[model samples]
Target: MSDSIVSLHEPGRAVLPAYVRALEAGWSPNTMRDVAPEQLAAIAADPDAFLFGLNGRGGKIRLHDGSEVDRLPGIIRWIIAARGPESQFVGSINLRWQEDASGKPITELPPHVLGHVGYTILPDHAGRGYASAALAAVLGEARTIGLPFVRITCDADNAASRRIIEKNGGRFVESFVAPFYGPGERLMYRIDLQS
Candidate 1:
């Protein structure tokens, strides 16, 4: 089945069950940390609120260190779902950016965040071109949202992820360790949406 990016909060999209299963099986939407257990518990407590909160519309974000901070402006999330009679959650993708005094989006991300876009696909659904397709779609969204470009990062050792970024027109920028994402040799890439 083909995959497409869908709204995380779509009323007709019943994504929680598949999402929960992925978390239970040790898959995390965020690659920076292992917070799936906490997230799963939160989802179990209130499914609707949990789904609605994925886009950071709640205005606050809890960090892996258990600290809460105001959500960054222009943060949005979408589910990567397999399309068919029964669409299933294969993964999630998100975009975040800082805002100016007038609330316009900026390319600068928060100090702790390593990239403008981040995504993770379930282990079972890997190697199917889903991440590539999703990144391409989100780059279009980025352009529509007035971003001239987007920066994305993946672990340097993660060849598959690196390939996905390059396939989406990502140009390698640098290699460094992102302390916020823990210890790892991370490679940064930029996709110029204006092109």
Candidate 2:
């Protein structure tokens, strides 16, 4: 478990020494069946390497040893350092978007948007509103960056996950079956930043 303060910055060499031992708490969550946390050092070395196949969002999810990490499809992960003498990282939120409506590929980004609420807090960090706080902070960044909306998703059976989405002003969009990574059905949520 990490005990250092949380700071938002590009993952540098500073990340290796930060999360090498974070195996137990996040690797195997209380409810999630197929996710695992990664060794911090490995992720810091290769930020893009963490992104796995699409869980939703038509993109991909970052994974370290089967657990999910926040991925930045827009910018890079603005590493959130925990606040305290405790060497803990709450969660990472990123600003990015899906490939344009046409898969033909375009150079410029689409409409106004900052980061998507990529992933929430690890299992051990749940119940403290860290997920909410991290989400709020991400929305704030979108506002500062002048975006119109943000999107997020969670498993349908995950009550805690639904709460996190709702707490951040997420509206129930629709529940659908995920194709790529499937242990079960996933619930997708959306929030209009302008609303």
Candidate 3:
């Protein structure tokens, strides 16, 4: 969202105010353990978490998801982030990825890919261009962590998410279905940070 801001949590420490508020609002924390081994290690070392709208006891609860829980089917664990006006932490996004749809395994980190970009913003944060902002934040994190590329997977039906990925300079890589998940076609996009 324009005029809104997001902030990165301090290394290995939770922003108590935002975190407690999110929990009081019925939010849970996600762990990278939900994704892959490498992802888990990364999250563990960095402790990436997000919080949003915890600005007060109740200024009108905006929205909170993905930050506490892995909205993505393949996500094992994740952290929370926050965003606000005059602040700089408004949305939640993750650096995680799963196997390629081609049945090829990604047991090890790829030199060109940091992981997948999974971003989510609260309802109130939507429509004001917050999604792309969160995505940009994640990209910065990727660069800081020395990642070269990232993947983004979206449900074929979610045009909104697809648009967000496109706005982040994602290129159409393929459209396929994930195993044991469902018959729904998924759009996989790739963005290279090395450029």
**How far is 34's C-alpha from truth in model 2 (Å)?**
8.2
lDDT string for model 1 (1-195, tens) is 122534343322365677788889999887767879988898879877776676445377777777878877554444555555766677777777777788677898877888889888888878877788877877777887788899999889999999999999999999998676678798999999986
For candidate 1, the lDDT comes to 0.76
Candidate with the greatest lDDT versus the true structure = 1
Deviation of model 3 at 166, angstroms: 0.8
- What TM-score, over all chains together, does every model reach? 0.86, 0.59, 0.55
Q: Which candidate, 1 or 2, has the higher TM-score?
A: 1
Sorted by lDDT (best first), the order is 1, 2, 3
Ranked by TM-score, top first: 1, 2, 3
For 9-84, candidate 3 gives per-residue lDDT tens digits of 4323344444334434533332222222332344445434322222112232111222332222122112233443
Candidate 3 lDDT for residue 71: 25
Whole-model Cα lDDT per candidate? 0.76, 0.52, 0.50
Clashes of 1: 0
User: Any runs in candidate 2 off by more than 4 Å, and if so which?
Assistant: 1-7, 23-72, 76-87, 99-115
